[model samples]
Target: MLLKSITPRESEKIIKIDRFVFTTFANIEALEYELSLGIKKIEAINTNYYLKIGGNEERIAFEAKIYLEYLEHFSGLVEKIKAREPLSLSTLESTKIRKILIDSFSAKTKDWLLDSSRNATYYTKEFSIGGVVL
Candidate 1:
């Protein structure tokens, strides 16, 4: 997801968000925020985000579109949650849907990414889909 997820004030540089994958609606909101601020560009329908969480590749390749207007004001909305669904890293039997997003990384990797303000906010997920925190 590092490739798809981006920070809004990331170097004032424009990046393309070819595709985004969030199990929860919060992830969608977070992605919308970045795009609205021009932090990154969510690619069109023909193309999409490729996020292979572990061996979960099928669901990761799902298709979706990012509306033009939503990308225009993403910054304002990321702060205002749309969905709120609390979730777990794994489910009892639902493997088709994207599972809860638990940061799976070494302490060093997380520390390095968060210590720097340019990347600190990257680790902090926001919004939710009916309580499923993304």
Candidate 2:
């Protein structure tokens, strides 16, 4: 399945965990340097985890699914970088390099959009939750 079912509460927790993972990666100076090299592909690696986006929610087995995905993607990227592989856009961008770049940007963008839209300041006011009027 493309999306996993998660309660709103569980989804919130996953989001927090995702933020921490992103922070760790963003703190890497080499990552910034690599990003500047350019994106070879816009698509990203497929993730097993997903947050409920305004739809039917399901129970999550654990909160670590997202973490595991982050670890998998990060490990792959590190391996490619360590092997002296190119991590940038090029007419001849290798499959490995393209996969890494795509996964990195996809995760980053997903977290950004989730965090940006999760402002408590706006939610503090009267509004609906899970599409149901409060």
**Regions of model 2 farther than 4 Å from truth:** 1-69, 89-134
Q: For candidate 1, what is the TM-score? A: 0.15
For 1-134, candidate 2 gives per-residue lDDT tens digits of 31223222422221111112222222222211121222234344773443333443211111122322234333453344345432333111122211122222222222322246685321111111011101
Candidate 2, residue 58: Cα displacement in angstroms equals 46
Superposed Cα deviation of residue 89, candidate 2 (Å): 5.5
lDDT of 1: 0.28
Query: Which prediction has the highest TM-score against the true structure?
Result: 2
What would the TM-scores of all predictions be? 0.15, 0.18
Candidate 2 C-alpha error for residue 37, in Å? 17
